[model samples]
Target: MTASAALTVIQASTLTLDDTQPRVEAVLVGGGRVLARGSREEVAALAPRARVLDHRDLILTPGLAEAHIHLVAYGFSLSQLNLHGARSVTEVQAKVAQRALQTPPGTWIRGGGFLLSELGLGGYPSAALLDEVSPHHPVLLYSRDLHLSWANSLALRLAGITEATADPQGGKIVHPLGTLLEGASELVTRVMPVPGEAEYLAAAQAGADDLAARGYVSAHTMAFEAPEAPRALQTLAARGELPLRIWACLPHERLAHARELGLALNPGGLFQWGGVKFFADGALGSRTAWLHAPGFADGSGTGMPLDPPDLIRERGAEALRLGLTPVTHAIGDRANHEVLNAYDALRPLAAERGVRLRIEHAQHLDPKDLPRFQGLTVSVQPIHLQADGAMIRELLPHLAKTSYAFRSLKAAGAILAFGSDAPVAPPEYRATFAAALTRRDDEGQPLAPGEALTEEEILWAHTRGPALAAGWADEGIIRPGARAAFTLWDRIGGHAQALVL
Candidate 1:
């Protein structure tokens, strides 16, 4: 018998996420899709001779999806220096020195996950500390937010950046030459060796495998990486080596090029390009999130704004015309305000095209801007609350009540999609579950208790919300003809394992 045509009956305790028949005792599968879902007796009678796989002890939920992640980059980060919890510069130096001890003198070393505030620094960190540890090897490390980069002198010299090097548009070269903010990072990244096709393929495989192991059946790959990143993923799909279904976006600057190449929203596959991405501002940790007056309570000037709202407004319409979702990254109040204004202009056209606009990281918001998110896909990483909670209280206390407003956004008519933005944070759903349900941050402090969501709501955000955002009708639920992909759990929000037919 052909493998695709083989029949089986899976008996389990299932939450279908379908209002019509939310609970199912047995599911009949054939050709990699669910053929029927019903009581064990009913389905058993229909597929009498089908092989039976019983797991009545476990709970089966719709497979999870990482709503926002830089897949390939995350894969590569698996081996890079991880600095997620170092509380002091000395701690970071020790780790860098160890890595350098094992590496060749001239090899470049890279890794990231540090937060300035977490490190207890009031201003930018000097590269001298890193230089002291690894003067022979160039080192480049990114902050946990991915909005800033700290490099040692050797790395900076290699990038040809000095006091004479002017800041690139939309980026900054923090004086004293140790850190690069926003656009300024590109200067060094551009100078770094581009990964060849093989490295890209390896990263793609490693990333997809890691997520599959964590019970993610799908992911929406964000578009901050180079073109090779997507191409590598496409290669995997073509070779049938891809383990997770991918819905990816391209940077908005590629919109004209995309139109020329006739790339648009094409659904139905292991991979698809469904959105065009834009960035309105940087992240809060970097003191670069574009904000309204009184910006950061720390007295850092209003953060740097990246893409102009006019550009998002004009180009967003173009993306919608191609049946593509215009996804923008808006972190601070002013950034969200400007993006909401820009999306307002696209609303009519987006409605006409039957498209849902998306906003990534609606992290901190003005009360006035909260309601404006209604009807948009607010794709956020609940995992961020674990670290960002304390920072919000210290840096932007004015918005604390509304920051990461999960319940408020959901009540306001927004489709809340959860993700981890991995590499910045590990795509661990347990952390997501805890952070979302508790509304607490790193220090065991609650930021906005009222904004906490129930476990079920968090599941919906990680499943159905992302499916709807990607315009996938058959995923995020269990029904006849649905993809035969599920996540088995000991109980709701417990240990998970993927079960894809």
Candidate 2:
């Protein structure tokens, strides 16, 4: 029971992947590392007294890693009003009304999961519809993509948003109805009371537990929530209660504060600081994706860019010097190109610091920019391909073949770290796998079938690619000296449950 001693032997149909194939009777564990991994006899001779934890016929692979997730925010969202699958405006209204009845008047009723397209609306829905459902309570519902939001009149009024209110920078207010897009959603959010320490801690726990339940053993939590979100996670890690290993990013705005606090890259058991996240553009669903020469195919004038490369370059170096990876949100071609340029300038420095610069969406790429992802981690959500396909065809037809170009990206030598981008897309790997492998959209239209990835490729992206993206070399692979984190199942890439450690 000393640091130099080994204690347990885990036997299974090991997916050591140490040599790219599954092993039948591997013995591993007890040193919190792979103490020994080989035929059962080989490992037993090395440490016969090691307590045995047998997985008789189960398949064992490296623990799955969700490269990108908004942990605390996702957790809080789970308990909030869920409107994710409402097919129509009426369905949304009915759900909001039902939730309102369950809560006292004047309490803020917040939920998300509505798709503007699914609502059968050509544009953003108005606040008037929601007003009719919860006139006494304030309500704000985010689009399934998290790019747009629909709020009731009361909520709009509380946020001081009116017909005369001008759209904020990088965001738009849909006319006549009071729905907000991109940056505009902040208007309503700013007025909401921040959760106390307890609330944050609880939400963090809920979110982490939910992901673990879905078979994720580690995650890279993007900074999209209050600072307390990560603080709550830190609290859990300190207590050794965090079930999944976490790599968290700080918002770019917080870089100076982190620097001032002397915060640097860290590994505190189940959690660590991995990067700083910035937004170069908004999302596709909200119509904020920054595009190329001839913007959206529908003529929306290429989407707007949120941050300039000049600024990203200036701040990115500082981030690297402090051991923080620079991760930017780039959904459109233009957005991806600009981030790539900035990263190109910082790549050498990033390498020197052992950091890997990353692009969060790399969803829609320009053919020319596709090659830029080589050696860089492109953290993408294949699940969004279903909903984005129709919009891609309608709004950005020219890039259709290359959009969500997993094959092309991989061929270009890019490290594709697949994720659900949860809260934006649900945290379901099966959906991610199906979407990437099938390339099927909501209308059953197959988009870029040639770009589809195989099931094995998809699994590798979700596991190894993400671990590499998060800079956790000790994870995502079943090998000597690697953490004992893993997911076991009756079958691989199918219905399964997390193997409790």
Candidate 3:
């Protein structure tokens, strides 16, 4: 569309989220940018020959942005056996058994999204539980939080993880033969079937399209999967087949290679390399969240620390120098604390480079450390709160008061970017809205009720926060010269759909 061409005016109860003029009745678009936004009559008059779409009952806002997700993994997960809401061990086995029946006897069966707590298990589940159902097929099911994996005997034997197997650094192997925590899970995963380039491309396309259908115009894909994952996304973007804009990260291990290839942060594309990702600790669900002092109330130890502070400080400095944001995953309080320490040291370099230091998951933090998040980006997942609420209460009751502290982090001057760590939880915007606005868990209990945000705050976090995190000035807002990407909702964050010019 040319600038001289007649504009397309979208009429709705437009919540622009623009501070100067927060609400407008209509938005005029031309050349994929917001040309004008005002009252229906005003905007209509500005674009007299414009094609008008009238939906005054619906609410239109800036397009939603998924702040953190594993795009390729989520796409692959779409085809995997879903164990998301399986409430019992029997239920989990039944699903696995059903999947096994459809497959050849000896094929590996990979699935995830079940919590040990939800399974009513007092401790880590044994392979015997799964062996009883599918002794022939190799099975590996991950915990809801993706921090732990449960493997059946066949899968274990394939990986050569016998009773004598030693735990890898920064990981654990739960005895009695099934669970692998942190790095230890890689043992079985390393031997599993690797998706070829074609599979990777398909998964990337599936993930992007899925998010677009869910009203997301863009996503910041955190690097947890193999480098092939981003390569596939890049291929999709180059072919113009990717439906959503993707801001991806390079795993810290590849930072040297990225720098060698002169991979500076590139903005303004369907896909861009935006950050360098690191893991400071494990997750909460697997009882692997790194905590301080008394650790897990149940005496499960203070979780596991993955990347060391010195390594983060050194490598993070290199990432900042290369124009990539240092995105650290710090879910537990201790992890957050140590990461903050590293960020504190690297703050000067980050400021000098004009890159925001980002912390992913910051799930549980001490109140004293919360202030340190000021002037940084805290990319968090509110949807996880629904499932982690009960776990937080039981495992870290002392820190429950500040867990998933969205409102607090925002108040502390931290930019809060909301996302669904999909496959861990579906990228359902309603669940994100419900969890943030209501501060309620799945058990009908409120978790740190004070951390609840207003509908507007939630919307801003879902939109503007992510744009800022990715350093995209033109996205996540509806204004002059901004990208013409939008989401229309029946109510603010109710049922929604994407509209890209």
Candidate 4:
């Protein structure tokens, strides 16, 4: 297309997200890069022979980048049992029982997207609830957070988990043998059938297509899914079928292997390995996000911490030396505090290497640590506030004032990158924009109105901030020499479509 196409001009009300020239009337594109951007007459004179596509009524901005997602898994989830809005166990049972009849008797049933708190459970759910419906089929269901799993009796038995089975490190097996938290879910996942190369490729395509359809021109694929997931994505890029550019991570557990393979940060491509992903703790919905004292007002205790802080400190330095950003996931206050401490130690090295330290989810935080984010990339999902707001009130009321603090983070000098963390939530930018602008949850209740961001700030976070985090300078803006990838919106925060040159 680049070789055959003539230089083209797009005339739109464009939000460039460029401080020096924030708005432009026209942009000239050729060979997949911006040639010039300015008033229509000025740019048109420069490319008088260029084809023109007018969009005076729409708003065009830098193409969106989904800053965090499990690409392949979210793709497969589009075909799995979705318990997203199941209000009760009965509702969930009906879905599972129906699937059971369709599936083989001994087959494993897999799906997720129900919050334990939302399920009206006093504690962990029991296998009996599922056994009543699918006594023949082994069933494994995950809570919305993916940090907890509810397994039926047969599923538990298949994994050889019983009352005698001890909890695994970084995870827990709830009493009565039905619920597994954190790393314990691996017991069942490891036993489940693995997808072959063909399945992986298909899942990868499904995810990339869905995001592209949602108006994303790029995405940061967080590495928590199977290793085959990234491989499938890379395969898509190599085949030139990938719809969007990708900035991906490798699980910290694979750090040693990556070092041995000589894998390091390699930027500028349709896909690139950019960071080493580490989980410092679990999620709030699962009651496993490591918190400070008196955690979870409901007496769930301080949430479970995942990786050791020391590991992050030590290996993080190693990661920086190898040119890979050390990306740590820290949802709770304690988790963020600890990761920040580890990051502090890595700051000098990070500065030396010109790589930014990144923290994902920075959801709940201690006010004192706010300033520490000055030079770091804080990847957050405002969409999560739709549900987590209510949970925070019930579970961590003390944080209600500071939670989802987009405005505060910005003031503290952090580069705020927004994303959906799809499957956990949809990559619906409308929902994300609404949550950020209104500071409201699903119930239409305000979370922290003071933390709300303006439409321009929201656009920057969704576009330019992600590009900065991924170390891509030619993206997330409309300017000379920038990539000709953009999103056309009917309104500031509404229906959108991708337009990649």
- lDDT to native, each model: 0.92, 0.84, 0.91, 0.92
Clashing pairs in 2: 84-113, 297-395
Of 2 and 4, which scores higher on lDDT?
4
Model 1 scores a TM of 0.98
For model 4, state the Cα shift of residue 466 in Å.
0.5
Better of 2 and 3 by TM-score: 3
Per-model TM-score versus the true fold? 0.98, 0.96, 0.98, 0.98
Query: How would you encode candidate 2's per-residue C-alpha lDDT over 1-501 as one tens digit per residue?
Result: 232234677777877656654574765576467656788887777776767778867877788888888998899899988877678989988998899999999999989977777788877788888888899998988887787888888888899998889989868888885688888899999997778999999999999999999888899899978889999999999998898899999988889998999998876588899888889998887778888879987676888789789889888999999988899999899999889999999999998998888889888888888877888888989989988888888888888988999999999998899888778778988888889989999889999899999877887898889988877788778777788788876777776556534
Q: Give the worst 10-residue stretch by lDDT in candidate 3.
A: 1-10
After superposing candidate 4, which stretches have Cα over 4 Å from the reference?
1-5
Sliding window of 10 residues with minimal summed lDDT for model 1: 1-10
Candidate 4 minimal-lDDT segment of 10 residues: 1-10
Mind giving the per-residue lDDT tens digits that candidate 1 earns over 1-501? 233326888899989999999898998888888888999998888877888888999988889999999999999999899999989888999999999999999898999999887888889987898999999998889999899999999989999988999889999999888999998988888778788999999999999999999999999999999999999999999999999999999999999999999998888879999999999999989999999998888788899999999999999999999999999999999999999999999999999999999999999889987888889999999899989887898889999998999999998999999999988999999999999999878899998899999988988898889999998888899998888888898977889999999
Put down candidate 4 lDDT per residue, 176-253, tens digits, no spaces: 878999999999889888899999999999999999998999999999888899999999999999999999999988
Query: Which is the better candidate, 1 or 2, if ranked by lDDT?
Result: 1
Candidate 3 residues 445-495, lDDT tens each?
Answer: 999999999999999999999999999989888889999999989888789
- Backbone clashes for every candidate come to 1, 2, 0, 0
Stretches off by above 4 angstroms in model 3 are 1-6
Give the true-structure RMSD of model 3.
Answer: 1.4
> Stretches of candidate 1 above 4 Å error?
1-5
